[model samples]
Target: MATNLLKLNNIKTELMVVASPSQSKEVGDVLLNVDGCTIRPSQEVRNLGVILDCNLSLQAHISSTTKSAFFHLTNICRLRPSLSDPVAETLIHAFITSHLDYCNGVLYGLPNKALDRLQRVQNSATRILTNTKRWQHITPTLKHLHWLPVKSRITYKILLLTYKSLHTLAPQYLSDLIQQHSQPRSLRSSDKNQLVTPRSRLRTFGDRAFCVAAPTLWNSLPLHIRQAPTLETQAQMEHDPPGSLTLQLQGMRLSTSNKSVEGYTYNSFTLQLEGLNVSQESTYPVFLFILFSYLFIIVANLGLAVLVFVDKSLHQPMYLLFCNLSANDILGNSIMLPRLLIDMLRLPSERLISYYECVVQAFTSHMFGTTSHTVLMIMAFDRYVAICNPLRYAVIMTNRMLITLTVSAWGVPLVLVGILLGLTIRLNRCRTLMKSPYCDNAALFNLSCESVFINNIYGLTFTVVLFTASIGSMVLTYTKITVVCLTSKNKSLNSKALKTCSTHLVVYLIMLFSGMAIITLHRFPQYSDSRKLASVLYHIIPSSLNPIIYGLQSKEIQNFLSKLFKSNKVLASK
Candidate 1:
């Protein structure tokens, strides 16, 4: 073979010492220098790590005549450990090649920084697993188990290694140095132009005329030249913020969005855009109090249901409605809290609900809500007649009439809610934006771009009529019951009536005034958050307090629960 020689600046070397024995003498000179780097040998892989076997030893030769470098690798993994000399030599060659373009990359870190990590990972026949927390469903990844079922451990190690390598390498590159790597890295248009412009490639190194005798890189990149202030500042201004990723076209970005941002910034007009910035990591403290309210209601209601169902002696008409209300309280929460739990797990962007789904959800929620209100009214009337007009109570509220009123109580809300659902759907929901976690009628109407005159009118009219009719019935029934009780000749009936009606009166008024205030606020365009929160007190506080009210009012319910708990304790002791 023909012979040739190269000279590299500062570090002279005869690479023929590392060449193959059979190879003819040849030399290709080149300089290889880095502006910045933090390269090192990777950590030792634990357990039975990679076992590589090979016949050929790694041999690198610089061809001066043809201007190329050749590497013959043999058992190279065992010798060099990481990124074998052959690979490093090839990388050096590519870094030096002038007829290359790497113009679509945007990075700011050192080259070959990740190459130092390859050997730390080793191939093993057996796999590994990890452990995690109580709340976590899948096992966690904090510590690895040395052995695992191959099928269960389906993640591929090689792909993981490559990704980690990229991560380690990416940060060291700036947007300008467009060096063509062994496997191509993308460069931006500016970087591509910079690469094509050969004069920008090198700066003086070591204050000497450079010479190299290897086919690999021989670049003279000075420390200050690596970060030219004028060039870097311009790069920062163009790409760092208000500049387009690609070349700016006549002074505009690519999309139709009025959002002008190269990065996430700006606080101006933000509350109008996002409404709230809730962190996923934090739980609202108010919800914990709400949880307590739910827990108390559940424990109380379950106790009451058990008493009515198991203790046959306690099963009567008045007690039956109490049980029904308790059960309804349970059902109401079943519909609400799970939704909040799910919403907590997701990011805000994923919390978006389709318009149709929102309308249906709100419809169902209010249907149950209004049913609870109407049920309280019926309970009021039942206690009213029983206490004041005891002799005529059975005849007046016959089973047929009770059934009819109950049916109407359930039916009216269902029908009104259906109408609300149909009316809300008439508006095109393409532009709809929900302001609350779950849908609310007021929020829906507010989101409509089209005139919401009919929607608001119907909602206001229905809310008024329903609240007045229910509240009026309670007032008239209780007042009549009161007059009758005070004037009754029977001393026993008067005393019983006063005690019974007093509790019902307080509970009814608590529910009524709160419900009316809530409906009243909806008529206003905006209400304070505390005012809105006041309505939840009507629903949540009453449901929680009902058991306490009834258990205190009725001696029978208290005794039943006390006896049942004692029996369970006896059974447990045995």
Candidate 2:
């Protein structure tokens, strides 16, 4: 070995051997002779800043780290009085904490007593930086500074390497050690990004092997986090400091708890939205078109609604319901479009919304949809009373009755959707990416890592009840109107009733078919492209068409619009 080293221009003095724990006792008294060079068996070897003992206990490494850390901490404490807080923190981190974290992955699975020595070093460094008294607790200070405990720091290092290995960003040796768990047949967890944990015979030694320990920790993370597309995204999902990853090991639950091992709190989550799959060239054109559609929806719906509010002669039951429908159109599109427009200008990766904003958007969306259907149902009833019981219509649909119905139309949806969003807020969300153009109840609740069975049941039940009540009431009222029309002897009454009901019926059918198409397209992934288009259209089309249908088809509204326009022309001429 010496002669070979000489041939390669390397010195033989660099060669050292620390025997395995099993052979340590026998080799402790023995010396090695290779190619006329005499070498002694070392009890501990220092390589690349880590001290590895014959038994591989890592005690020497930990002791060296803590000693060096305390040495730096002592020096920093002496100058801490002169240094500002930020400068002091920088010095401490540079001198003390960095030493503790150097190559700390090899210290995983050590006994608590062994790890606590290094923990004290960190705790002291934190205290000196913050000028915190020794009698005070340290956990809060560590959390405030976003520092992980020594044990968690060790786990973080290992898991980070594991993540890199799985993503092919680590060394080939590490990538080779990681094996993805696979099955011959599909299972419930088939889509979960799980790794195969190799079997280990000994708890102390075998369990610490990279192949065993890496998979064991990797599989414990939530499925959504494990499946994050990028390392930055995974770090964001964990809600740790910029470079650290939080885990639910040793009583921690992804920073959800305030106990030990819990390093940070999640103040808010940023969600990623998947908008239309437009090419770079088409993005601006698509955005402009969507902007035009949204502006039109606002102007048309609000214009019609304002016209109804201003014109006292058009204050009858059917026109009042038309006004309600117009308001709903403006609201529904507003809930979806403004944020969507802003997101469209951003890159796909930059399309982000806060957790609270998402919940509000979702709640308003449900309210807008449900209230629109309710108003349509109410319109059918209004037509039924007008055509079938014209004499009693004035008496039945009084001012008080109109107020009550309008209030119910808006208030009931608010309460129901409030309850739905309340359920969603209580869930602990593990995923931050939403595969939708905008926030909705379905998309928001699906981000939670836990089972949303209850949310699904309640949402489905609310939808079913709302649809049943709206559709049933409309069908029964229209059926009665049909029977009355066919049997009535008055041609004038028949013609007026058909004209009035046609506009409402057309608007209702458009909304119903568009909604149904969106729901149907979601069930088939093959129709994802179509689903995105349909979802966008579902919000904008009904809103845009309702005002046009009412303005053109309803004689009363048309006459009112004509008079308003003529008066405007007369004033302009004057």
Identify the candidate with maximal lDDT. Answer: 2
Output the worst ten-in-a-row residue range by lDDT, candidate 2. 259-268
435, model 1: CA deviation in Å? 1.2
For TM-score, the strongest prediction is 2
Error of model 1, residue 252, in angstroms: 23
Clashing residue pairs in candidate 2 (N, C-alpha, C atoms within 3 angstroms): none
- Per-model TM-score versus the true fold: 0.49, 0.57
Task: Give per-residue CA lDDT, model 2, range 321-346, as digits (tens).
Answer: 77888888787888889888898788
How far does residue 281 in candidate 1 sit from its true spot (Å)? 9.9
RMSD in angstroms, all models? Answer: 22.8, 19.2
What value does the lDDT take at residue 46 in candidate 2?
80
